[model samples]
Target: MNEYQKFREQIDEFMQHHPQSPLDEAHRLYFRGLFYYEPSPAYLVMATVTRFSAREPLVEMETSTGDRRRYRRWGRAHFTIDGEAAALTIYANPYEEDFFLPFRDATSGKETYGAGRYLDSHRPGLRQLGEGEIGIDFNWCYNPYCAYNEGYSCPLPPRENWLAIPIRAGEKVFHSSSR
Candidate 1:
């Protein structure tokens, strides 16, 4: 199996049996596994980051539980899909040195999580920075913990990060008959 599929397997194992899983005991029994789009090379990208200056201000992110969380505007990622231009602002957690990328594509509320998906330090694929480019593999994008269980409050993608195009990759909406 490929690395992406292996990653999915690890996630499945965690969600199914880990005590700290977002899924409660009752829900775990009904969860076969998370659904994912077949890995697609098209979504893999090396985006050039435009670092923010001191002039850039911090932004507040709205969460699923209606709470506001603040993050510093770190930089902007500029890349393309099939030669079509696209850009997303990258945020940095005020208390931590990790990057945060919350986004909603055309697939949201349909093929994927209604609130949005996330790509950040919590996952492995996009953590390292190389020069001015950051490797972003949409295949690593995942639904926030809230998607599996409402008990978890996850940050929603900002309006600027909402993509007009569909990104048919990574994790799809979870399905559980028990819900």
Candidate 2:
């Protein structure tokens, strides 16, 4: 198997066997596997991250539990997928080394998790931002823990990251036995 396929398999194994998996014990009994689109080249994008002149106003994104978390609009990643132009807003919290991207596309509430998925650009990925480009593999996007278990509190994707196009990649809506 190729790297992406291997990675997907590893994730599936973790979700099925790991104690910290989002799937609850009862749900794990019936867990088949996560749904995913075929690994499409169109969804693997290289983006140019253009930093903001200054940090944008802090937005308090509400969580699944009705609590809120503060995040600042750090920058934007501009790229194209399947000849369609698109962009995603990056958010950062104070004292964080990695940047967070919570986004929702047309697939939300249907094929994917309704609240949205998250991507984290780690320190190495952040370093590329200074170089004007960062790899954005939508194949790595994953549903929040709240999708599998209600006990989790996940931040909702801000309005800015909602895309009009369907992103047919990454984790799909979890069809748990409990749900």
Candidate 3:
């Protein structure tokens, strides 16, 4: 199989037993407004991430939940968007064994949500990708459950993940959250 195909297979395998698979649930479509530095057409990216690491093999990690969940590490990754190549860095929580992407692009406090947003990379199968070189796709970027719920202490994005450019992707800022 090709690289993307391989990646898809890994993602599918991960969702099978992941804590937030949403399996058997009805599909819900939410509209997210993404803005680019300049006026550029928006592209459709999967907008997700998977976990990876040798010490912690399962993409899943322990969280506030009684059971464990999945997460992705922030490492080195390469992507080509609209034929332009970009490199990114991600972060990992050793204690929680969670991988998260907390980023603040030019959109901070502007077109998109401010205080940065996050993506959960908790796919066990895809976790392997991060174990090595550790570069990943920003397409899966998402908002922590805290964006919608008030009882969770989702890890906030670190200052290092903040990018100077406009991400124009993923979930928007939760206007109600103190973050």
Q: Could you say which candidate leads in TM-score? A: 1
What TM-score would each prediction reach against the true structure? Answer: 0.93, 0.88, 0.45
Candidate 1: which pairs clash? Answer: none
lDDT of each residue in 77-168, candidate 3, tens digit only: 44455555554445565566465555667766776555456555573212434234443444445555544444565554544455665666
Candidate number that wins on lDDT, 1 or 3: 1
Q: Indicate which candidate wins on lDDT.
A: 1
lDDT of each: 0.86, 0.81, 0.46
The reply for model 3, stretches above 4 Å from the true place, is 1-74, 78-88, 95-97, 123-135, 149-151, 173-179
For model 1, the run of ten residues with the poorest summed lDDT:
122-131
Q: Give lDDT tens digits, candidate 2, residues 54-112.
A: 54567799999999998877778998987889999888875574688899999999999
Please report the TM-score between candidate 3 and the true structure.
0.45
On residues 1-179, what C-alpha lDDT tens digit does candidate 1 reach at each position? 98988889999999999999998887898878888999989989889998887466678899999998889988889989767899998888876668988999899999999999988877765755676789888889999899988988889999999999898989998887533
For residue 90, model 3's alpha carbon misses the true position, in angstroms, by: 2.3
* True-structure lDDT of candidate 2: 0.81
Off by over 4 Å in 1: none
Q: Tell me the lDDT of model 2 at 137.
A: 77
